[model samples]
Every structure is written in C-alpha cells, then in structure tokens.
Target: MVDRKLFAGHAVRRMRRRAGLTQAAMAEALGVSASYLNLIERNQRPLTAGLMLRLAEVYDFDARTLSAGEPGGGADAIRRRLADPIFADLEIDRAELEEWLSGAPGGAEAFARAYDRGGAGTAASDAPDPGTVVRREIERWRNHFADLDTAAEGLADELRQQAGDLFGAMAERLRVKHQLSIRILPLEVLPDVRVRLDLHARQLQLSETLDPPSRVFALARQLALLEARGEIDALVRGGAFTDRAAERLYRRHLTGYYAAAVMMPYARFLRACEATGYDLELIRRRFGASAEQVAHRLTTLSRVGARGLPFLMLRTDRAGQVSKRFAGASGSPLVEGPGLCPLLDTFAVFQRPDERIVQLVELEDGSRWFTSSRCVGPAGGWSGAVRARFAVTLGLAAEAAGVLAAARGLDLTGGATPIGAGCRACTRADCPQRSAPPAGRTLLLNDRETGVSPFGFAGD
Candidate 1:
C-alpha cells in the first residue's frame, strides 16, 4: 500500500464479507480500529505479516496468499459491466471500480447481469469502443509510477556496486548472471522478434535490424523482466490492473522504466542532465539511450530530494493518437484524454522527419508553452523497420521553459496557434480542421446560410 509494499486487501475484505460480518465486528476480530480495517479493505493500509498471521487464526485459509495478496479477479466482470453505453460519459477510475467490485462483487455482478438482461438501452452500436475503453483506463494515470522508480533505482544501485564504472553495464551484469551468449541475427532471420532468449542454449538472439540504443534497450528490458520478477509482482499488485491487457502494459512499462534507470542511473543521469542544460543529444551520448528514452527518463525525474525540472513528455503518431503522456510536476494537465488537435507541433513533425520542430504555443485559456517535436525514427520510414514519422512531443510551460537547452535563444514574440485537446470536446468552432461540431453545441444552420468556418457554433 505504501508505494512498493506487498499486501492483498481485496482478499481480506472479500473473506470478511462472505462471513457476513460488519466493519466494527471485523475490525474487533482483527484487533484493529474500524478505520484501520477500512484502510486495509481499501488497500490504503498494508496487510502486514502480523495481520496475515492473525487472519490465518481468524479464518481457515492459508495466510501465504496475503504475502503477495491475491488481486481481486473482478476486473473482467466489472469491465463487461462498464461496457454498457450508459457509463460512457462517466470518467471512472478502474482502481475505484475495482474497490467497488471487491467490496460488493455480488452486487456488481448482479448489476452487470441485469444490464446484460437489457436494463441498458438497446443498440449495441452505441456501446463505447472497446479500444477507447482500454485507452481511457491507461490514460487515467499520469504515466509514471514511483514504485517502478524505487525498484529500478535499487536494481541500478546493485549493478553499480557489482559492475563498477561502465556505460551499459547492466547488460553486462545480466549476461554474466544468465550465462547468455549474445547473437545478432540477420534482419530477415528474426524479422518480428527484436530480442529472443533461448533457455536451453542460454543464447540471447537479437535482430541486427535494431539500432544500438534499441538493442541495448531490448537487452536491459529482458534483464529487468527476468531479474525484477519479485519487484514486478509487487508493482503489479500495486498497479490495480483492471484487466490482463492493463497488467501486460504495466509489466512492459515497468521493464522499460527499469531498463532506462539501468541505462541512466538516476544520480549520474540527473547530474549530467543539469550539467548539459538537459541537452538530449549530449546526454544521449553520455548515456547509451535513445532520444525517446532520454525524454522518458526526463519525465521520471520525480524522485524525492534529488529531483530535476518537471517536464511534460508525450508521444503521438501523425494521427494525433497518444502513445505515452506525462503531466509533469506542475500538476497541469498539459493534454487530456485523446485526439490531439491537428495543429499541434507533434503531428507537424511528421512532414519533415529530418527536422525537430520547436514552437511557442498558446492555449485557448491564454497559457503559453514552448514545445519541441522530433521524429523518433528509422529516417525514411525504412520500409522494414520502425516508422520514421512517429514523433515525440516534449514541452514545458513558458514560465519554466528555461530548463530546455534550446530555450536560451527561443523567440517568444510570435503568435501562438489556437488549439484544442481534441475536436469533439473542443469549443473552438472557427477552425477548418473541425471534423465535427462540439459535443453539446448546436450548429447555426438556419434559413440563412452557413458561417465561414467548417463547423459554426450558435455563440460567437
């Protein structure tokens, strides 16, 4: 419950409810305060070893499950329940939904059962897209988990002690531990597989198609997954994953986080970032990391005490679809939900894959920001490799843009574009890129004529 600690509060709450006991009764039975019991039920308080031992005596179940604490299996059922279009407009957190499901899983199931029985309105076409639901669940988090930081930092420190002073030493340490024989196969040999491990031969095969940073990254990622199993389990328990997909995403994310931390050990990375004025290329050279990796590592600078400038880093394709987004320390939601405005610099970088686009932009509310977008690339779309047009947009509030090395000569005298997070919820009706009118607004299509803009609103 305390970021990285292990406990399964869901199991306790479920068992107690099954026994048909009140909170006060359960609290007294557990020898804790009713409020404390509530915390335990909600997973806000950990089910300590002592508590697990006591629960064994109180109930006739093995206490070992509490060590890792079984995560409630209501994710899929609750997901099915939320699939009803009636819940479409609601911005519900899966964590909170999971809590509700755990506390009253029977009720949750009954509600879903009733909904399936046509309590929800007809027309399956009206249901939210399953893909959209998944994205929303992922977007609920700010994309940084502190527990990964703790785990990654611990792994990096251990490697640092063992490997001494060497760049990309984590990979070396893993090679020794796993008794791995590194092999770089032809691009055509393992076309889809970037990194493949053979348990029998202790051979690690990598596609030569990958660049240096990517190859190292794949190795480090594999190492993280293999070695950080316990940490990953704890992170997963703490992840509150609503489905297997979310859990998989979290695992990959954790592995990537650990990989980056190993590649750029926090202490050295932070100092280098400061010394280099946060120059991505310079730091990339100093540390064997890619531009995307460097940008991502920048966002994870949220470690306590030795923190760096909080920069919001987000990735998007030419279609304005968000792949990864971080809110930074300012707590300002730089971008929300999905469907970025076509006018944003991120999408624009797709045109000139060779160039990095930097601009000063103003929001509708008049807040200004300095943003830079660069294609994280295979240059010419490479035909066989990663897309060259996929760009990562990194930005900082105008007030805090000094952290950027390029901000020294950044011109702020220009006008900024009128942009919106997305078109459906966007209030701006005077744009040519308007695919549809704002959700609640009415078009001024009367007896007269249409306005100059593609989508015209009733109000000015």
Candidate 2:
C-alpha cells in the first residue's frame, strides 16, 4: 500500500513559530532550501517523511501531532458541521473543503465557531456547555498530557523504590509527605461517596464497598493530589476554561489521569502491551487494574516516538447513554457524541456480559476500525441496590488490527460491519438499527412499501 503524503503546512508553521525560528533558520536547521521550506509551509508541497524525521531529530517535534488530525475546528469538523440541513443546498465538495481548509484555516475555524454559536445572530453571552468545553479541550490534546505522564512516572518510580506494592507505597507516601492517614470506612458511613479527603482530620476516607483495584485507584488519586498538584494545576490553567465548572471538571480528570499513570507507568505499560500483543486481560492482571482502567491507559500511550496504536474509547450504560469518551489519535467522530450507532458492538456486548466482542467496522467516511468491547462494573457491587452495568469499548484504525490479540483469526479486509457516527449525522438509509432519520435528508414515506429500516430517507 502506498502512503499518503502529509499536507500539514499549518502544523509545520506552528512548530517553527513555537520554536521561535524564522523560516530561513528552520530551513537551514532542517537541511533544506529556504524556497523548498517556504513551499512546504505554504501547502504547495507535501511534508516528506525525511523532512519530518529531520524536524523530529533537530527540534524534538512529535509526528503524532500531525496524525492527530486538524486541530480543534479544522476541516473535518467544518465538513461534519456542513452536513446539517441548513447547508444542504450549498453542495460543497470534499476536495473543495480540504483546499479551503489548507489555504485559509483561520477562516474555516471562524465559520465553525459561528455555526457552533447557532449562527452570527446568537448572543455572545451564550457560553458553550461546560462539558462540551472540557471534552473539546481533552480532544485538542489527544487525551495525552506528556508533562503529567512524566511527573506520574517519576513518582511511580520513587514509590516502587519505597515499597513492593503500589497501593501500599502510595498510602505510605501520603502518610509521610502530606501527614494524611488512610482510612477505609463502611458504605453506610459514607453512603453516597466513594472517596473523600478530610482536611480537618488529615485523613483520606474510602468506602469499604470498593474492590481492591478501586481502593488502589482512590489512594493513587489522593497521591496525585498531594504529589502532582503542581502538574495538575498547570494543565488546568492551560485549559483556559471560562467556566468554573469546566475548570474543576478538567482538574478532576487530570488527577484521574495522573493516578492511572502512577498505577501503570508509561514505559513499563507500553512494553507490556507490545509484549502481550495489546492484551487487555493480561495487562490488567499485571498492573492490578480493572478492565476499564486498562482501556483508559491504552489511550494515553501517545508519547512521541514510543507511541502505541492510537485508540479511541467509549463507555456506555445499558440504556445507551454515553458517559465517557476519549478520542485519542484516531479522532473519529463516532466516539465524540452520545448519539452513537446502535449497531455498534459496544451495545452488543451487553447481551453476553462474560464475553468480549471484537469486530471490524467501517464508518461512513470509508475508514475502517477494529473495535473490542466488554461489560464492566456492577456499580451496586452485590449490595442488592441498583446494579448499573456499562460497556467499555476500545477502537483503533483497522490497519493496526493485526497487533491486537482480540482481532486474532478475524479477516481485516472485507465483511466489515458498516456503521455510522450516529443516527443524526449518519447517512446510511438502510440500517435497520437506525433510531432516527439523518438530519439533512428528506424522509421517505410510502404506504405501498415497508422496508427494513423504520425511517427511510432520500440519498444525498
């Protein structure tokens, strides 16, 4: 297969500017002519693999940034936004949109921002939903924070040297460094909460109902708060959240990320994944983490040259409500929203809770992904309370399926299940699992015909 030439002139320019280098200086450093570098930066020439290597060697650039796709409101986002019925009459071609994005990305971003604001007439005070803002921020960074990972890895190393077990080490660190004692109380004592830090008592309280893995996670999160506060605060500040709620939510997420890193540790985890052919069960046992925790850690292995396959993850309850999603490097729209296709294996895994479901699915954009999902957690935990079950899914581009143990013995090509981003944005008119018609298409109703799909719509 031939490789696609990368046309990331905007990214190249951004890298140069961030390094405080002029075009001529950057070109000299890259061992290229000024004219050639100028063309490359102007999108007139594609960024070659050799030049990309030079950029990495000289300036310590991360090639994964280009693979993360366009930043924020770039071409892909603008195209998806244009799919709305409001722009149906425009008939914009894909190539034309790409050209426009490459030439004037700022203009494209402005248009996307305007559309997101419900057009230019909407009030400026109408801030975006805080959750949306936080999710976007996470996606902007591809759900990988290098500084946090580094800090957590260092702490993990120190903890390992201090004690044999991670949890014990984390607890001891908290007790010694922060004057905080660890206390596990019964669920009845802390009915609604799972973990809490009592500043006045100088104790970290955890509910006894939590399993061993969860207790370790709780301890690690507190350790993150005590040891990695500077790193977490820096990341939250860098997010520039306009809403206090979003900032707080993002900080919590950062701390959780740190805890996961401290538990798994980047270099060791990546080595284990590669050795195990990306086996989740084995890795989970090795790290003493739960299935969901192992999956979440897989998404954060985006550390420059030692990067793992870029996977996206989604968590959904039995009711089909998506609670969490991380886009990683895939940047596929399927994981970006709650309204995902019902035909996905993530929903199917609920039927056979004990088994993991792995399938090759093709999206409407002609991209194929290898997905594996399994049911996790009975949040009530045998207490006879409301038992909420959720499915956790991890997916990456199909090309990398061979590296995954779950995809073993499966055909990578052909026989892929055709799926959509969601019912609203999905253009698949014949999918029986579609709950609603696509947004921009006209609904077709005929008394003489009763098709497989509940709602039929006109094709684009």
Candidate 3:
C-alpha cells in the first residue's frame, strides 16, 4: 500500500485540468472522496496505490508520474545561472519565477542565453530562446519521464507474456476503459498526419504507411498520452505558459518525447547504446527508429546513476536556421552566442549529404569540442510532399571524446579549427570567412596597409 507520499502535487492538479474534471469529478473517477483528492493536490494527504491505479485505469495515465517528485524547476536552475554580479540587482523566487517560466519559457531562456553569452541581449537569432527554455525544462530532469520508458518496457514485457500482440493489448485497454476504437487510415487523407484523435467519436486514426516501429510508437504515444497525460500536463502547466503558441509548441515537444521513449525504452536502449558504442545506424536498425530520432534520444540518456555518454545534439537547416538544440551535458557545453561559423564542417554537410564529417573545434579561449555532423533528410509520413532536410551534429567535450566510437582514428590533438559563435564575438585576426567584425571591436583600416582578413579588429 504505497501512499502517494511521493505523488507530484502539481501533476495531479494538472491531470485533473487536462481531463477537464472538477476535484469532485476526478475524485469520483479515482474512487476517492473529493476531499481526499483535494488533500492530495495540496500535499495534505497522500494517495494509496489503489487510488493511483484507479486514476490510471480510468484516465489512461502512466502510473510512473505519481512517483516522479515535486516541481520547482525555474527558481533554482535560473538562480544558480544568474548568480553572476551582472544580475545581482534582480530578485526572483520559486513561485514567481515558476509562474513566469510556465507562461513564457522562451523569454526566460532568452534571458539565460544572453547571460550565458555574457551579452546584454540575444544577438544570434537561433540562440537559446523562450521555446528552448520550455523544452529544456523536461530535459533537465529527463529521467522523471523515464517512467514512461519503464511503462513502455512493461508493455514489452507484457507482449512477451501474452505472446507478441502489445497493440491488441493496448487497443483492448482503450476499448474496455476509454471506449475508443482504433483505425489505420491510408496515406491519402492522412498523407500529412501521423496520429489523429477524435475524442468526440472516441476514435484513434493512424497512417497505414507508418513503419512497424512508427506504428508501434504512434500507438505507444497515444497510450502514453492518455496514461501519461497528467505527467505531461504537470510539466507543461508548471511552466505557466502565458503565450499560447509557446505552450502548444512545448506541449507537442513533451508528447513527442513520450513517443520516442515508448519506442525505445530507456533501459533497453541504453544497453544497445553501450553494445553499439553509440553508433547511430546500428541503434536505428535495432530499435527501428530513424537516425535523427536515435540522435535526439542520445541527449536524453542522462538519467542519474544510469547515465550514458554526455552527448549534446544540434540541428540546423541549409539556410543556417537552427531548428533543434539540446545542451544538457555539463563540461564545456555547446555555447550559444553567434551566427554560423562558415568554416565548421557542420554547415558543409548540407552539400555532402551521405558523407560523414568529423570535426575538432577550438574556441578563442582554447576549449575544444569533438563532433560528428551528417545531413539527414526528412523521413517518410511527414505531411509535406517534399520532406525538409537538415544537418544534425552530435558533439561532446574534447576531453570526453574518448567515450565516443566516432572519435576513433581522429587526431584528438591540435590543428583544431579556431571558431567563435559568429563574427560578432570571434577574435580571430586571420580568418578568410569573417562575416562581420566582432562586437565592440574597431575595424582596423590604414590607407597603406591591407590585411588578408577582411575586417581585422584593432585589438586583434
């Protein structure tokens, strides 16, 4: 009889809200008194295992969320980062900052990005923004969502026990508890969609063209959403999103995380990562996930005590627009300051799609990074007629490169390309591809003297 002593209070409230239930309504669904649910939400009383399961059985929630713990994200993480003297004048609290983070994570991240770059404002358009803050919130304690991974693994176990029909098991759960019917539609009307839920019709529609892994993942995501809705909602509502667009964007991000986790259960996936030395192709084939998905999931493997390699992920388009980024690793993390470094092979791979490009990048301050960059075209079942394309770069600190299989045969020594966030902050005096002079630097020009570098700063 595990009491909800470990229950996430905010999460319970959020689940109730997402279900559009009153305290009385939610309590009734959970087979508990309205006062008891009220107490649970207020941390005045803990829910028993019976009530927890009842909530899940009724609402399709993953039970792991109940044990994930309390939410106080923005206050502590933001405070530590802002401890610098530059922001000593401002005072922020757990409740106040949490409210702000919930409502406008992008703005909060914009502030953190500016601070991380030691700048007055965000100079690079693609640098960490409020949207990033929203996504990073879940990523910060990614293991909390590892419960979804465990649930996925549980379903996998059930498949073995029931002899290989997890979808049937899941569909039966939907039908019995949720009164929902499942349909696999052809890619004609669903050409651009992945999963469509018709709550009014109590129907779930998925694309027939979805690969086996994707089809299972879509089913898992739907189940995870129903069972884990409270978990996702709690994380989303805790940020207190003021902007509807940012809220919806982050909600989708959280949902996709559940989908990926369900597809590649964390523990099972970690075993594969170790056996494969974090090789993207092998992991993709083994899990039936895409290379891009495998790469993105690599960044989320930082669960405590069960941590894997500290790999950070970044993706950018041909036009130099950074679409996705995660810098969860600690040591010399991928900084967010300037525009695209024209010299880094990360951008060049756009032309050489199939080629594997490895890089040794050194900053002006002498820290180094090891990275493998490759161009990945959009996968099938993406709504558009023409799938989009982007280059994904997986990188690690230079000292930590020893843990990665991709770093083999490469000179871990010198001859590294000296790069900066962009021309605005770059101090390199001799670069052929300087886009703009570094900020606060006076462009050096003498009538008789011409330097090879387009705009050599006076200091440089």
Best by lDDT: 2
Highest TM-score among the candidates is held by which one?
2
Name the runs in model 3 displaced over 4 angstroms: 1-130, 135-156, 163-179, 208-213, 330-335, 381-384
Q: Estimate each model's TM-score.
A: 0.67, 0.88, 0.68
Better of 2 and 3 by lDDT: 2
- Error (Å) of candidate 1 at residue 59 is 29
Question: Residue by residue across 83-139, what tens digits does model 2's lDDT show?
Answer: 655675688987888777777767775675555444456565664566666776676
lDDT of each: 0.65, 0.80, 0.67
lDDT against true structure, model 2: 0.80
Q: Cα deviation in Å at residue 189, candidate 1?
A: 2.4
Q: Output the TM-score of candidate 3.
A: 0.68
In candidate 1, how many Å is residue 254 off?
A: 1.2
The candidate, 1 or 3, that scores higher on TM-score is 3
